[model samples]
Target: MLNVLSILIGLLSLVIVIPAQIPFLGIANWIALPFIVVGLVIGQLSSSNGGRNLCLVIFAVAVVRLMLGGGVI
Candidate 1:
């Protein structure tokens, strides 16, 4: 259940970021970071491979966002 919640939170973060304006990129990613962290922790705790995969995806998105200069102020 926690794994699912984590995935959902990560997905919600993606949804939140998708339509963000350039000026709001930093704020959007900052908001998303907690979701990503939670997802990763859940993934580590869960034995399911799918949960781990979702966490990987969340990490990838975070990396991309950072690379795009979105998550840093």
Candidate 2:
């Protein structure tokens, strides 16, 4: 459950960043990357699910989270 929560919270961070127009957000964006990556790694590296499916899902979710947080989503 925490994995999904982390994903959602990461996405929410992006959602909140949407209205702001600061330059530092690009840097702030880097911070979120590890969280997404960790979550992805956890979901993929630990799950019995094949690495390909897990890696893809993790990468996709993380990128989407980044985009939403970066105002691209």
Candidate 3:
């Protein structure tokens, strides 16, 4: 429940232009990892491994998006 919410919030948190930003190899994007960890923790606390996987999947998608942008943002 909370994990899903966090994932949703993280996804909708901002609409930064990925192509417009590129510095230090997109290191700033790592900042998002914390949100992913939060989602992971919330999922773990709910005793739902499925939720954990769901968060991880979300994390993977985000990472892929950053990479597709040529690193991070």
Best model number under TM-score = 1
| Distance from true location, Cα of 15 in model 2, Å | 6.4
Which scores higher on lDDT, 1 or 2?
1
TM-score of each: 0.68, 0.37, 0.49
Instruction: Show where candidate 1 strays beyond 4 Å.
Output: 20-24, 70-73
- Which pairs clash inside model 2? 14-69
Candidate 1 vs candidate 3: the TM-score winner is: 1
Cα error of candidate 1 at position 17, Å: 3.0
Model 1, position 34, has a per-residue lDDT of: 73
What is the C-alpha local distance difference test score of candidate 2? Answer: 0.48
**On a 0 to 100 scale, what is the lDDT of residue 69 in model 1?**
76
Candidate topping lDDT: 1
Candidates' lDDT values, in order? 0.67, 0.48, 0.58
lDDT of 2 by residue, 1-73 (tens): 5445445544544443343325444444455556555545654544343433444454454455556656432
lDDT tens digits, residues 1-73, model 3? 7656654644532222232245544454466567667767877776446667766776676577678766644
